[model samples]
Target: METLETLSDKLDTTGDIQSIVRTMKALSAVSIRQYEQAADAVASYAKTIDMGLTAILHDRRAGGLSLPHTGSTDADVAGLIVIGSDRGLCGRYNETVARAAVDCINDRTAVLGVIGARAAARLEAQRHKADRLFLLPGSVAGMTPMVGRVIVEIESWMRERGVETVNVVHNRREGRSRAVPTSSAVLPIASEDLQQLADARWPGPGLPFFRMDRDRLLSWLVRERLFVLLYRALAEALASEHATRLAAMQSAERNIKERREDLTSDYRRKRQETITREMLDVISGFEAVSGSDD
Candidate 1:
């Protein structure tokens, strides 16, 4: 029932909307590439760290170097770091992470740290209050700073609350253009992994010796391990965010194209009908004038 002028206006509006959606899709694609590259770069460092740890632990077995501390933390309390998207354009990204986080929180006394606005909102809606709310980086370049801040916060919680175990929950890149929610223990290094490394042989052959005090070197390596874990987790989460956004934008582009086609067809039909009606009016008026003259 829309007039020709109205249809024309709608067509123009839809065209503008489609342009904006396409631009967003293009930006999402670029972001995905950048994040993926960053993730790959960090992944290499992580691999190196793992190799160093394996060597150090193998040496420790021969030298009888034990951890300086008993590696015992308060058993009753724990901490969870929940990573979610700051923005909401990507469909269900925040919700999925939030749900996974809630499921991971089996203890009522566990402290929760939320990163990103959308995640905090979802937790709040569930009547769960976050002990701390951290902001996500606005760009890929800011990831290091954010990770550093998070590490400091986690340390503070450990000191102040005697939190024993720290776990991280986030979405990790799966297959091509897909992300899956994952939860992992990040602190107090799982005993099983440590035992496995302890029993395993070093890859190269000859036993390597460290120049520094064995305990000090081990402590430094442990810190490096923790840093790498946090850094890699943040990088993975960012990559997953970009992937989700890219998928969402691609879906939006498809819907927009379909909508534009429908609008274009409707406009053409309405314009043709308007022209035919005008022609019929002119013919009737000409016939009336001819009859009068006769």
Candidate 2:
């Protein structure tokens, strides 16, 4: 049985919480839009890179030049990159990605790299240690440098550590507000995919020609391809994070509204009871006074 004052205090506290939740919801919505736009922009750039790679490969095949092998077939070491969120309040966004990374390990000797603090903590809780930890970019503008750093790390792993295969695990935006955890192999550009690109009809009337060395051109195209893939992953992961947060905040807002309604009802009922008790006391006193006078 709480007093009226206590009930009033609870109502006020709930109102403040509701305001905060609404603010968070608005911020999340804005962030999701920006990140989704970034993802779209990067996707267009990726298509351009793919076209360039296709032209180079087509020319080489026509000239009887051997296609350079992009990925190693007989390597023992593996590299794993896990992208997640640094902040919480996103309903297991970080934990889900960490779990996916763990499942992707598959008993291989892996050099693991983590991109978010919260995600790294989750992985550590599962008795897994990361070889390197990279901070997640706070905004779309900051992602380029972050991706560059990741590329350097990947190169180091392959060049210095003899890592042959590289894989990335993250949550990708599925629909308007849903995220699905997925894993993609980043290294060893799949031969089948390359062949498909090379075999496709050229979009233009004439095939473009380049004077640069074929192998050098292929290497450059491959690097750009990696950058495009990494950038797109980061953008999608960030968008998914904001979508999850928006959903969580919406749920919190609903709960807070219900609680506030219940508290208001209780306050009104108690106040009415108090008023009735006071009225009864006044009436009884008047009756006693009249009897005394008589």
lDDT of each: 0.80, 0.88
lDDT of 2 by residue, 49-133 (tens): 9899889888888888766688764457888899988998999888789888889876564699989989999999998888899
TM-scores, each model vs. reference: 0.90, 0.92
The TM-score of candidate 2 is 0.92
Steric collisions counted per model: 0, 0
What candidate 1 gets wrong by more than 4 Å, as runs, is: 67-74, 203-213
List candidate 2 stretches off by more than 4 Å. Answer: 284-294
Q: What is the per-residue lDDT of model 1 for residues 1-294, given as tens digits with 9 covering 90 to 100?
A: 798788788878888887887787788778777877887787888777767777777776666775234254446778899888887677788888889888888763468998888898998899877889999997888988888788788889778988868889998878756778899888777777777666766677676666987667777777667777777787788778877887887888788788888888988998899899999999999999999999
For residue 199, model 1's alpha carbon misses the true position, in angstroms, by 3.5
How far residue 172's Cα lies from its native spot in candidate 1, in Å, is 2.1
